[model samples]
Structures are given as structure tokens and as C-alpha cells.
Target: MIAFENAAYSYGGGELLSEISLRLAPGSFHFLTGPSGSGKSTFLKLCYGELMPTAGRLTLFDREVRALSRDDIALTRRRIGVVHQDCQFLDHLPLAANVALPLTVAGRAAPAADLSDLLGWVGLGQLADALPPSLSGGERQRAALARAIIMGPDVILADEPTGNLDWDLSLRLLTLLVELNRMGKTILIATHDLNLIRQAKSQLAARVLRISKRRIQLAGADL
Candidate 1:
């Protein structure tokens, strides 16, 4: 779990996020909404240890962020999965290999059966042998998701996951995420899509968090 206690982050000597004190409980789902450049991505970076807060304390898995070493952060990141707005892949490698790259880097074995199952779970079963350049936007997004969860991380953090896809494709991705939440993964998605958040609320207990005026606010029914 990630916790921020009165945490504030600064960039170029200016505060970007302030007073962010929130806990991502196990198996919980949350949506972070904010306008462009409102620190949504910055907050996610802090959560995953890419950036440390300038004031107060931010903890990951129980250890204070500032106290963790570089290797410690790498190990901690293995337990947290992230899906970026722009999916990156090895264009020359097959889809399955791209998804399995993390295991390779971690010096772990990639079981063939498990990799197949994961690709199928993300609806990319048939594309396992396809190159990255041949995929559509939604396909690339789903592939990114598959890569994120290949290690079976405890928490999933998605940044504008459905930004480029059409409404139907977006709903498809949402269903996959909801299914993951049911399977007991802590999920936090940073997005500006209100309709997607509203749709998710109807199916599960998802909290809406709005980042406004340099802080995080727990949104009510007004979302």
C-alpha cells in the first residue's frame, strides 16, 4: 500500500502537489481526476517512487520513500504496476516477448503457459506473435496493461489508460480493470474521463478523487 501524510511535492522550486494524505487500501479502487498539468501524473510518480515528496512523508509498502535506496525502490516497484498514457514496446519483438521483458530483466523465469494465459486475459491471445507497429490504439493499450500485470503486482496504477480509444474500446478496458479489482488488486487510475468514472461507480465501489487547487480532494456524489 502507498500512503502520503501531509505530503507535498515541488518542481523547479515550486510546489506542484500539496497536502496529499491518502492511503490506497488493499483491494480498493480509486479514480484521480484533474485537468491537464494538474499534477495527476506527478502524484502517480510519487506513489511509485519515481519522485520523492519535498515535505512531509510518503511511504510505499510501509517504508518511508526518502529512506529507501535506489535498489529498494526497484524492488518495491516490482509490486506496483503502471500503465502509461503512451505505451512503449520493442517494435522488433513479438507482443508476448514485450510483455515478458520485465521477468527477463528481473532474472526470473517466464513460464510459457502463464504468459499465454495473461495475453488471453487481456484479449491479446491471437496477437502474441504480432509486432507492435501492427496493432491499433486499443490493442496497444491492452498490451500495455498485460505487460504491467505480468508480474502479478499487488497494486495497479494507470495514467490516462483510455485516452485514445473510442467509447466502446474504453468500456472494454474498464471491464478488464473492474475484473482485476474483483480479483483483489488495489487499483488507482489517473484520468480526466468523467463518463468512465461514473460508469465504473455503477458497477463497483469506486471512490472519485479530484485534484484541484494543488491538493487532493475526496469527491462526493457531485462527481
Candidate 2:
């Protein structure tokens, strides 16, 4: 589980997040929603240790984030899988290599058969040898999702994952996430798509959290 205890963050004398306290329970699914520049991405960064809190405690799996060294943080990140708004990848590498990157970074080789199977699961099998720069928005998002869970991570954090995709593609990605949650992986998605959230309500027990007024709240039905 990930949590923030009285947490606050500031950048260049401007407060981005303040008194932000929340918990991501294990095996749970949540959607982080808010207007632009509301610190939704910053909160996701804190969850994955990309940014440390400026005023309070940020804990992951019971350990205080500030107490961990850089190496320790990297190791901890292995337990987490993050999908960025703009799916970062090695443009020069083939789709397969990009999706299997976590394994490559860990010095573990992924078998061709397993790699192919993973790609197939995400409907990218035929494009396994294609370069990242060639895939469409949905394909890249799917590839990012495939890469994230390739390591079998315990926690998944995605920021605006479907921001650039069409409705059908967005629904497809959401279905993939819901499937992952059914497999017991905790999932948190930061998005502004209210229609997507409403659609998800019928398929999964997902909670909506809104970052507003320098704090986090369990956004009521207004979402």
C-alpha cells in the first residue's frame, strides 16, 4: 500500500500539493481526477518516489520514503509500475524490446515465447518488431501497459494514460486495467475523463479521488 501522512510539496516557492494525505489500499482500484495543474501528476510522482514530500511523511509498504537511499528507491520502484502521460520508450528499440525493458534493466532475459505471448495479450503481437516511433497513440499506451506489468509489479500508477486516445481505445485500456485489478494488483489512474470513470463504475469497485484546494478528498458523486 502507498500512503501520505500530512504530506505537502512545493516548487519554486509555489505550493503544488499541501496537507495531502491519502492511502491506496492493496488490491484496490482508484481514479485520481482533477482539473489541469491540480497536482494530480505530482501526487503520482510522490506515490512512486519520483518526488519527495516537502513537509510530511510519504510511506510505501510501511517504510518512510525519505529514509530510503537512491539505490533503495530504485529497488522499491521495481515493485511499482508507472505509465506516463506520454509513454516513454526507446524509440530505436523494437516493440518487443521496449515492452520487455524492465526485464532487460534487471539483467533478466525474456524468452521469445514469453515475450511474444505478452505482446499478444495486449494486441501488439504483429508489431513486435516495429519501432516505438511508429505505433499509434493507443498502441503506445497498450505497449506501456504491457511493459509496466511485465515485471508482475504489485502496484501500478498511470498518469493521463488515455488522454490521447479515442473512446473505444480508452475503454479498451480501462478494461485491461480492470483485468489487472482482478489479478490483485493495486491500480491508480490519474485522468480527467468523467465519462470513463462513470463507465468503470459498472465494471469495478473503483473510488474517485479529487485533488483540490491543496488537499485530497474522496470526491463524492459529483465526479
Candidate 3:
């Protein structure tokens, strides 16, 4: 669904990512690993059109990202879900409202039953009325995942999703992602957690990619 050809992104002095060439096909699961500041998040941003390549080509859903208009980019984003390390949300909004924000922003109304079912599926049914600030780290991560998928995006990009959670919570989040993958969502997660990647491999087929010295490389079998 997304392709990068010799894609390079530069900022604040030099390139953060260079010569990135990869295709994220439908129903594929990929784990992106790299050391801190190695441009894993930058690559994800390029995939979703949040950032454009400074050199080379990046395309989303068969359209060149650089050629897309602002509205086009916005429309394209509806087909992609993003989860961040911070799980950004309006602190004062209730979890239900937060999860429904995508629908609200798109000028669509969410059915109450569907909303309830989604929250319940994420194990947040009882905490729907709680404010985001009141949630624990794991709760917030699950809420973020819930909000991300509410739009029914074709692709999911998560940057450091398990960064703040413990092993158990991280595994729970991974399980949710694996379920989504089984349901045919294209998944790309950028993380430093090798153990988490190994755990995912035990349950599903996942390709691992690593970034080093501003280049992307296929991980070795020993990963």
C-alpha cells in the first residue's frame, strides 16, 4: 500500500533517513527496529505522508506523495492509522470521546452500539467515561490503538508503541495488533524492543527491518 524508492529525508543539518526502498503490501506485518535517532519514526512518517522525502520517491496507495494536495493527503490519511509513543489525546476528553474523535473530525457520526463494541473489544468498556489523564500507561496505549482503528484504516503505523509499557502490557498490545493483522490490516511498527519482535514471530509471520547509519536493511535470521 506504500512504497519508497531511494527515499531520503533531511532536516536540521543532514539526512535522517537515506535511500529507503521498501514496499508495504496489503496484509503484511513488519517490525522496524533501529537505535535511538536512527530515523525509524521518520520512515513511518514518510509512509503515511506526514513527512515528504527530500530526495527520491515516496508513494501512498499508488499516488506520489509529493504530488498530493493537502486535502488529498488528509483524505489519504483516513486509510492509515497511527499510534504514537505518547498516545496523544485531549486531556479533558473522556475516553469514548477521544476514541470517537476521528469520526467527529471526519464529520461522521458513530453508532453508539459500534462505539460500545469497539471499547469493549479493547477491554476499555468500563472506562469509557474516564478522562485520558486518568488512565494508566497500558490503558492509554490500548485507547490509542482503539482510536487508531476506529476509522477502519487499511494500514497501521505504530511508533514505539510499547515504549512505556511493561512486558505484559506490551504483549497485550501486540496481541491486539496480531489480531488486526489476521483480519487483513497492513501493520508496520517501529520499535527498539527485539524481545517483543521475537514474541510476535512466535505467533505470526513478521518481517523485521532495521535502520542503521541512516540506511534501512533487512534483519538477519538470528534476530
- 7: Cα error in model 3, Å: 0.8
Over 4 Å off in model 2, which ranges?
none
Error of 2 at 115 (Å): 1.3
Candidate 3, residues 1-223: lDDT per residue as tens digits? 8998998999988889888899999999999998898888888888888899999998899999999999999999989999999989998889999999989999999899999999999899999999998999889999999999999999999999999999999999999999999999999999999999999999998999999899999998766
Model 3 regions more than 4 Å off: none
The 10-residue segment with the lowest total lDDT in model 1? 214-223
Return the clash pairs for model 2, or none.
none
Model 3: lowest-lDDT 10 consecutive positions: 214-223
Taking all chains together, each candidate's TM-score versus the true structure is 0.97, 0.98, 0.98
* Clash number by candidate, in order: 0, 0, 0
Candidate 1 ranges beyond 4 A from true positions? none
* Pairs of colliding residues, candidate 1: none
**Tens digit per residue, CA lDDT, model 1, 50-140:** 9999999998999999999999999999899899889889999999999998898899988999999999988999999999999999999
